[model samples]
Target chain A: MSATLAVAAAQAKTKTSNYARIYWPFVVPAGLLVFAIIIAPWVFTLIMSVHEWKVGEDPAFVGLENYIRLFNDSRFQWAILRTVYFTTLAVLFPMVLGIAAAVCFHKNFPFRGLARTIFILPMMATPVAVALVWTMMFHPQLGVLNYLLTSIGLPASEWSYNAVSVIPTLVLVETWQWTPLVMLIVLGGLASLPQDPYEAAKLDGASSWQMFRHITLPLVWPHIIVALVIRTIDALKAFDTIFVISNGGPGTASETLNIFLYQTAFAYYNMGYASAITVVFFILIMLVSLVLFSARQKTTFQ
Target chain B: MKMRGLPGKIGFALSVFALISPAILVFLWMLSLAFKNEVDNTAFPPVFIPNPPTLDNFRAVFEKNNFFHYAWNSIIVSFTATGLALLLGVPAGFGIAKSKASKAAALIMIARVTPGLSYLIPLFLIFQWLGLTGTLTPIIITHLVITVPIVVWVMIGFFEGLPAELEEAALVDGATIWQAFRFVALPLARPGVTVAMILSFIFSWNNFIFGVVLAGRTTRTLPVAVYNVLTFEQISWGPLAAAALLVTAPVLLLTLLMQKEIVAGLTAGGVKGG
Candidate 1:
């Protein structure tokens, strides 16, 4: 009896080891990749942010001087304001338009599927390609946008060429590209909603708008929140379209933090300042994400 | 109830048409530009249709620029990054799902949420130090930053959705965990794999910033090549449109072919958007 008990214990030990073998081998690569690729570099970024170094030069420890300079810099302040303004528009337009589009597409209309497919085309198309097409369209004299404006008895304005209108114009391009994403997410939520409420509301003489406001809106609020967070984060880091179209041009009009960071790092060779910008940019994104995520949790529970 | 028949249908259809026309018109304009001559493309009225659609823009794209070479580079970078991401992420996803390792999964999510520029700066310095810039190797590696999280995230959702009883039964029958995963879970996760693969490929293909910073002139991807055309060449709308269309064509084709899977993959998780 004792011998048999000992043998059983040995077998259990082997089994546990076998499980560990499979688990470790399977999970280690991903952990290692994330560490090497993401966490390590970010740590390096944090360290570099405190130093003063240009490209091809030895680093010197500066200890928050870059951050100090950033605080006092008017251009940095403008970038912060512009990023907020751009993100607000980019998120606002898409959420409103996408929810509206989703509601419209949710109905039993003809060619709804076809219309949706076309709408999402802009979303799926490469960003650089999208920017180039829009750049051509935004041309002051030769572009079709101006041509359309004149034909419609409206004035032709310098789209991205003028400093004052550049952020809005860039946001317009962003809205064109991302509205479909919001629409798709909301459509998913709409499809899965319980039909009992809508059916009961109709019987009780609620108008369609009333039903949408009372039932549909509350139900899909979580989805709208999710879309809001995603769009906000993306718009904050929007690089390709802005970089390709304006390159933070017309004398620093549309230079969001991402654009400024790129120019600082690559174009100007200011590595230390760029790293500082990266750290701040990362914190801003995290703060926004935290707020939205907490909001998501609240709505999701409700 | 008042407007319930043919008139309602017509009105609904018109509304839908008006809504989708902007989306359609953008593509149509690009198409017209690609097919029109330089004179027709730049006309103030903007020729809506090419009288005779010309392939000359495409010809110019290939001849004047090394368009084919950049396209090849893009293909290689996207394919390899996607392939490596799958190899690394699938089993990891399965392990996390089975073990309920939420911490590891969250670690990977941090990778996704952080800005790409943060990664780019340090990686750029490291690569320059290692003499690895200007090679497809660095570009492909950097793309993993985009691709791996996507694969891991999607696969986690899929693997968790899978029935656990099958793997347990396999384990109870004396099959090891690896065998169970290889034979049972992986096969069950085929649709997930397909979705992950397609989404990662589309994303890696569309990525521009990594290539912009890392690639040499000869190693440029199609998007970078298009950017060069815009910046360097005189603003010839036809060739510019043609170049843009070429960069977009492969992704556009993928979207059309596997749109259902793409949508599923996209909506599968919300960690990575844009």
Candidate 2:
């Protein structure tokens, strides 16, 4: 009986090893690529951040100096504030519009499918191309947007060209592109909801707004949170559209942390400073993710 | 369900139309600007239609730049990156799914969450040192940073949804794990593969930041080329809109052709940033 028990243990070990041999071979290649391509560069960025390095100069170790300067820099402070400001507007507008759109489309209507397809087109088009076309449309004189505003008895205003309105204008473009993404996600959530509660609510003669608020919204809250998290991350790292439309123009009014980092690294060739900024930017993203995900967990339990 | 009157139905339709018309009009506006000549493009009333739409803008776009060359570059970069991503991600996804390795999946998510610039700055210096900048290789490799995670994440969900019985049957029938995967699992995963391939291709093709930094003048992709047009050509609305349209045309065509698959791919990873 003891020998039999020993044999059983040996067989279990071999079986596990065999499984490992099969699966590890499959996983290792991708793991290596992830490490080499994604992981290594981040490690390098972290290492570079501690030094006082520039393009065409020798790197000198200056632990925390770049970060020290970063916190004190007014421009960096404003960039952080602008990033938060832009991200809040970008995420909020889309969530509101997307939830509204998803709810509207959830009810049966003529050409609903066609409308969804049309709505997602902006999300599909390349950001650079979209930005260029929007820049054209946002033209103060000859652009269609101002023309429409004027024809509607509203005064034409500088869209992205003005300093004060630059971030909001950029957020408008961001909202236009991303609302469909949020809509689609929320639509998926809505489609999966059980019908019993909604049926009971209808039997109770609840108003549509009440039903949506109490039933649909709670049921779809997880999906909304997911969309919120995705949009926040995307908006935080928004580079292509802003780079094309304003490129942090009107004297850097639209320059978020991303644009500032890009200018520091590429335009100014301040690699060390940029690396420090990258570290901060990454931490900010992670922090937001943690907060949003905790909210997601709470929603899941309720 | 309560029956609606004709007035109610019409109102519903009109509201839906109002909701979607902005999306339609933006694309239509881009289209109008693309086909019109400079005169009509910048007209005071903002011409919604061209009385005599001409191909001159398209012709000028082609003439002013090496548009075909850039298009070819985009094709090469996008396809190779996506193909390589499939090669790496699909099997890894299968392995992780089969093993229930939640940790590995989380690692891939981390890669997706990290900003592109974080990887890009260091890679830029290294590529320059390795004398690999200005080549398609670095762009293709960096694009894997985008494409691989997408493929892996999508495939993990897909493989998890797949039943394990068939693979187990293959294994019991004197087949090795690889054989079971190749014959039973991969064949069953065609739809997932298609979705992953298309999404990865579209994303890689549409990427601007990678090409803007890594691609040289001769190796510029279409997005980067369109950007160059913006910077160099003084923003000629006719030609500029035409160029923008040209860059977006392939993606728009792909989206139209594969809308269902694209939507599935998107909502499949409903939690991730597209």
Candidate 3:
């Protein structure tokens, strides 16, 4: 027994030493890249927010000026309100539509797989491609959507060009592109459901609606939260679709914080101000994510 | 029973059709628009079926736009990024998983959650300083941000699920640790590798924000190229639709061909059983 134990200890010591050498080579580079790429940029944005500079000029330290300006600026406030509105509309519509679709196809039906695939097609397509297609379909005079509306006796509206319609139009396009993501989450949750409760409900002579209300809704709530949090984060950071479709529009009507930052940093060449906006945007995202995460934790605890 | 059965069947059919109709209609409309000429594209009523469909727009897209170049660029960037990501991420994932490094994993998640543009600008400045702004290197490296985490996260789940007994047995047979991983672990993880490849490729192909801000005219990607077409030309619905369709065609075909794999890739690490 002593001999066997000594041999095992030697093997264990060798294994531990081997693992130490093999592990650091993989961990260190990945760790450094993530830090430089993600975490450092965030810190840089925060630091740059307090400084003032144009593209070529040296950054002049102006403590609290940018934040002060941000608070007093009317356009910035308007952008915040508009972004909140856009995020709300964009997130809610997709959530409701995706849940509806998931519920519809939750059970085994003929061509169910095909139907699910088709629904997910939009999500898989490149966002730029989707935006370009919608841009054509939103043309004022000859676009298919306008023609359909006019044919149905509604007044034809300038979808993308008109200031009144651009934000909502962009929201609709976003919802159309993202609803499939929500459906996928919900479908995963639905599929993982235990069947005993469902079978019990059926034996109790409960209708489909009752079963859905009592069992499905409660069970899928976590999935719904997951979908909402993901969509909210994505929607809050929306840029590519809006950039392609409207370029933030005829006015600043469709401009979110991201668009604001892009235009300020690149187009206007005001890096300091753009950095300020980015810092604020980051904080906003973190706060929203934290709230959602805490709420989820509470529910899980219950 | 018969009366209820008929109603239930009809209700199920109607609901399923309703859920699916929007997507199918949009796809069909895109297809019809791709083949239609200008006159047919804007006829009095929107034609579901274009009378006498033509290939002129497709020809125009190919001939005028150098679309084949853009396609090649996309393939190169996506494949190279995916290849590099797998090389780096798989071993990283295995190390992290074995080490139980949740903090390191959370750091990766932080990278994933932060907005792309926030980091993109600073990186743009850095690339400008390095004089590598226009080349494919910047874009490919930038894309690693998207692809690596995906590969790493998926691979973590895969490696964790794997039995350690195989590697132990290989080690017991006098194999080196690297040999145990290379010979025993990698071959068994082929499905996860496939998932990583398909996903990383799809993401790198679809990504537009980095390409737009970083890429110059010579190195423009398909998504950026398509956006330029929208902004540059007169809004000719026919040619624009044709361009959109042409840009989407390769990816659409890929998704269709690898539908099951793509689905598996997206759902990886999301569900427990999956």
Candidate 4:
């Protein structure tokens, strides 16, 4: 009996070990590729940030100079401020609009599914494509927006050309493109909500506003926070659309940190300065994410 | 909860329309503009109805531009990247899931969050060193950065949700581990695979940043090609809109057709519902 039991245990171990061994070869190459492509680049960026180099020039060590210079750079400051401004507007508008849309579409009605699909179209469309479309739409002359304004007897404005208007217009474009993503996240939250509290609220003769304020708000708070955080990070690192639409615009008026960094690195071949900007950008994103995560934890715990 | 009745129904319809009309209006305007002629496109009143609708813009896109080449490039890059991502990601996901490697997944997310350009510059250097710059190979490999994590993260949830009993049973039937996974595990994970495929395709197809930086004239994807028209043209609204629409139309159609599938794909593992 003892001998038989030992043999069975050995057989089981051999079978499980064989399975593990078979899968390891497949896992390593793919796993390494991800690590190489994704993780390695960030490390490379960090190393490159400290080294003073132009394209085709040997990188020289410039300890803390890039970092020090970043603090005093007015353009970098402006880019940071502009990024914050854009992120603030982008986050705030989308949160309000997304929540409103989610609330409106939370229940079954005619074309709710179709409405949801239409809403998400912007999210699915290429950022560059959307930027192109909006560029034409927001044209100062011969564009639909100006055309509409003039037809309605309001004076037409140069939306994209004006320095002050450029950032806001970019913000508007970002809002249009991304509000649907926030809406979708919140919609998922709303749909997953238990029906009992809502039923109880109705039984107590609560108004829709009251129910939303007291019940729905608290329940979907996590989703709201997630959407905000994700959108914040995305807005902070806003590129592609802004790049295509404005190319940092009529005299760097619409430049964000990413564009700033891109120009600093690729266009100017100032890798050290770009790297310094990137490190700062990375910190900003991490800080925002940390705050949001902590806030979410507190809300969920409560 | 019970339905609120007639007044409620009326209010709901109005609210829904109000919520969705802006997006619908924008799309409709784009569609109309795409079909309008140059004369009507910039008409003073901004013609909503293209009275003499024409396919001139699309024709212009096809005739003057290398639309077919760009489209083919996009298709090959997106599919190849997605395909490679799947081959790599599924196993990684299974391994990560089985090992419960949340840290590995978080590391992948960090990569996802970092702006593509940060890496693109250095990668460009590397590609140049390898003499592979301006090739589809670099784009496909770079796109894996976008596609792989999405596949792995999504599939992690899928693998976790799956029952282990079937695989165990296959093992009990004296099949090798590879055989069990090949014949049993993968076939059962069709939904997850589909979700991965759709998302990977969308992301890969719509990727503009990589194409812009990496692609040469001969190797340009649709977005890059469309962008070229914008820079190259003398700000001609008609052809530009036409070109933009032509580039966007296939994606738009694919999106509409796969709306249900795409939604399911995106929201999968993130949320729980059908």
| Candidate that beats the other on DockQ, 2 or 4, i.e. the better one | 2
Assign candidate 1 its CAPRI class: medium
Across A34-58, the per-residue lDDT of candidate 3 in tens digits comes to 7766677777778888889786788
Model 2 chain B, poorest ten-residue lDDT window? B265-274
Ten consecutive residues with minimal summed lDDT in candidate 3 chain B?
A: B265-274
What root-mean-square deviation over C-alphas does model 2 reach?
A: 1.8
B60-94: candidate 3 lDDT, tens digit per residue: 78877778888888888889988988888888888
Q: Which stretches of candidate 2 lie over 4 Å from their true place?
A: A11-21, A299-302, B1-3, B271-274
lDDT of 1 at A195: 89
Best by DockQ: 2
lDDT (C-alpha) at residue B48 in model 3: 70
Q: Clashing residue pairs, candidate 1?
A: none
Who wins the TM-score comparison? 2
What is the C-alpha lDDT profile of model 4 across A129-219, one tens digit per residue? 7778788888786789998888789998888888989988888888888888788778878889998998898889998888888888889
Looking at model 3, give its docking quality level.
medium
State the DockQ of every prediction: 0.61, 0.70, 0.51, 0.53
Q: In model 3, which runs have C-alpha deviations exceeding 4 angstroms?
A: A1-24, A300-302, B1-4, B269-274
lDDT, model 1: 0.87
Question: What TM-score does structure 4 among the candidates reach?
Answer: 0.93
- TM-score, A chain, model 3: 0.90
lDDT of 3: 0.80
Per-residue error (Å), model 1, residue B193: 0.8
